[model samples]
Target: MKKIFISILILLSLAIASIVPFFKSVVIEDGKTGKSLAFFDAKQGSEFSIEYIHSIHKTPVREIYQVHNEEILQTEMRFQEFGVGMPSGADEGEVFAQKGENYILSNMKRTFPSLDIRIGQIIANHTLLLKGHEYPFSGLSEKGSWVSIKVDNLNIWQRLIGGKKLG
Candidate 1:
């Protein structure tokens, strides 16, 4: 009986250790409650974009980022109109241009270990564009709330009970 119990424990440990990493994901969570909103496997250099309509400007806006070394790096942003929070021009080494009706800021190397985004209550319509798919902010989280996005390494336990994944 003792040997059998030891064997079972060893197997369980091995299984947990192996199974945990398989579900590791980059997760987005609600800041107020720490509830997970969504997750996805983001490989190095994998690109994604956040699109939303500016509440005050009522113009379309998109921010592009890339995943690298467990962090998200801002690459560029495009917007239809310049508003209160919009950048009038780019800094040194950054490219700013107007393409059609949209102004673009590109060639940025800003890195974020974690990002906080406030969900727009109505007109913002925050959306996540990843790997040719779209995730609506309304489905991922509640409006008018703050969300934290980061690459979190969840163990086997958290993965087993994780939130929605970006399919």
Candidate 2:
């Protein structure tokens, strides 16, 4: 009886260990429908970014983020020129600099549980950067729709039925 109990405990531990990897994912879901548009496997400290062209300035801007504490933390930003909604200088606990033509803001501590973004109908050219690959927003969802980006732990069934991976 003792040996049988030990074997059962060991098997249970192995089952849990195998399911953990399926839990960590970066989920891009439709805000209105609550359907996952795309999901990709990621570790706890992985980083991803979104790059888009400023609609008015027509310059480029990139926002870098890191997965931490089961949330997405906006860590840095690179942009060209100052315009509406553009940061002129670093606020408290932030570092600002300029590298060539682009201005960079680093060491930012903004945290968001999820981000709701509206894809542009014609412009903005939103792109997701992960693992040195680029995924255009247009390909993830339709134009002018809202998407919520968040880090979610999906169960095995959810992960199996989830949307296409970013890769």
Candidate 3:
């Protein structure tokens, strides 16, 4: 009876441990605007989308990015310039848009020189929500034009075990 009880406890603990990481959340911010673009509940291989807007030649431009595994896999840009002052050669009924893969990282790096964003690493700072609780992160990284805050996978075990008390 004692051995059976111990085995059951071990299995239960393992089950809980495995389930904990999925509840973690990620928060992404646009440093230039000082606004949060997305709050995502993410796992190691999960995907999510973020949107940004800019202006060019008095035209409003919007871009949506698809992020997966800490990498931006696709992007779509749309230019909003519908009115009497539209460019002379522009297509009146057509939307100006462009999309491709592996473009965001380089663009972001060039645009936000202070942030120094990389392709594979997650950015620090901003709020991380895990299992309905909020934990503000403060780590080393220059605030630039964009930033992403995600639960550190390397510290998942610590987060899962210590999160309850911290939260």
Best by lDDT: 2
User: Which clashing pairs does model 2 show?
Assistant: none
RMSD of each: 2.4, 3.4, 11.6
Tens digit of lDDT per residue, candidate 1, span 25-96? 578998888888778877778788999999898988999998877788999999988879899999889999
Instruction: Assess every candidate by TM-score.
Output: 0.87, 0.86, 0.33
Model 3 spans > 4 angstroms off: 1-8, 11-26, 29-38, 42-58, 81-146, 149-167
Where is the poorest 10-residue window by lDDT in model 2?
15-24
Rank all candidate structures by their lDDT, best first, as comma-separated numbers. Answer: 2, 1, 3
What residue pairs are clashing in model 1?
Answer: none
Q: Per-residue alpha-carbon lDDT of model 2 for 6-87, expressed as tens digits?
A: 9999999887865775578899998999898898887877899999888889899999998887799999999998999899
Give the RMSD in angstroms, all C-alphas superposed, for model 2.
3.4
Ranking by TM-score: 1, 2, 3
Model 3 clash pairs are none
